[model samples]
Target: MNIGIDIEEIKRFQKLLKDKNFIELVFSRDEIEYCSSKKKNAVQHFAVRFAGKEAVWKAINKSKKLVITDISFKNSVLGKPEVYIKGKKASYIDISFSHNKTTVVAVAVSSK
Candidate 1:
């Protein structure tokens, strides 16, 4: 198994969100919708998901650059985090996220 983790400041993402290109380039449509759904806490949600995609990118250990939008997420019926790659559920990957008022963190373990 391979593991990767990432942490980011929520305020940084709050600033980045002002750029529409950044949002479209990094987040999938579903991700945008889901995060936007949070409304007031949208920045926190986006930051956490950004860290999650970065963790997944590192866990895969790919030398080539990854298309960030290709990595997205959803919540299971039970509210567990689920990773999706290229629009399909990636069963080989397990991911988790956490955040506070100022920061967000994510971890990914790949069993590929």
Candidate 2:
């Protein structure tokens, strides 16, 4: 098992969201749609997801670089986020995110 955590300021995503190509490159199509549907905190939403994916990637790979789009996230029925990795092992990865006005934090734990 392994664990990883990451944090980012909400404002950091504001710039990343600007480039259409970057958005496509970094986020899954559903994630892009979900964030776009938000009336407020759209950038923050994407940013938090990004942090969650990054944390999971760091936990699993340790050395290999990760492509953001390779990691996916979705909210459970209870509104908790879950992580799903593309073309990866069947291992389970649990992820959580929390945020305030200025920042967001995420943690991921992987179990084999």
Candidate 3:
């Protein structure tokens, strides 16, 4: 099993979310839509998703050929975050995320 974690500041994440190019280049359609639906704490949600992606990448330890947007989140029936890279699935990956006033953190574990 490989584990990876990431953290992001809420204010910084909100700032980056305002940049269309950054969003377009770093997030998938579902991710953008998911954050849009959050409304109240969209930045926190987006940041967690971003952290999820980063942690997943680190766990996979793949080449840099994979971009940020290459990883995405999909909720399960219980609204649990599931990880996917490109169109491939990784059911073995476990994800956890949390946030507060200043920051959000996410951890991912990939067991082969």
Candidate 4:
């Protein structure tokens, strides 16, 4: 088992959101849609998701060819985050996210 964690300031993503290319490079379409749907809290959502992807990348420790967009997420019925990789559900990876008024954090545990 491998575990990874990441923390980031929500304000940083707020600034980064202005760059369309960065958004496209880092997040998947589904992630964009979900985060954008938050409207007022979109930046916080994006930051958390971004950190989630980072944590997942560290946990998997894959090659450099693995881009950030290769990891994605979908919220379950109870609003729990579920991890997906390369467009498929990654059952072996368990992830969670937490955030506050200014920061967001994510942790991933992989049984691979």
In model 1, where do residues sit more than 4 Å from their true spots?
Answer: 63-65
Q: Compose the digit string of candidate 2's lDDT tens values, residues 4-96.
A: 899999887888798999889888887889889886979889989988888888788875556767898877679877776784433488888
TM-score of each: 0.93, 0.88, 0.92, 0.93
Tens digits of per-residue lDDT for model 4 on 75-101?
888989999989989999999999999
Q: Cα deviation in Å at residue 87, candidate 3?
A: 1.9
lDDT of 1 by residue, 30-74 (tens): 789999999999999999999999999899857436677778999
Candidate 4 ranges beyond 4 A from true positions = 62-65
Tens-place lDDT per residue, model 3, 16-107, is 98899988888888888989898998888888898898888888775346777778988888988888878667798899998899989999
**Each candidate: what lDDT?**
0.91, 0.82, 0.85, 0.91
Show model 2 residue runs off by greater than 4 Å: 63-66, 87-91
- Candidate 3's displacement at residue 21, Å, is 1.0
Worst 10 residues of 3 by lDDT: 61-70
Candidate 1, which ten residues in sequence have the lowest lDDT sum? 61-70
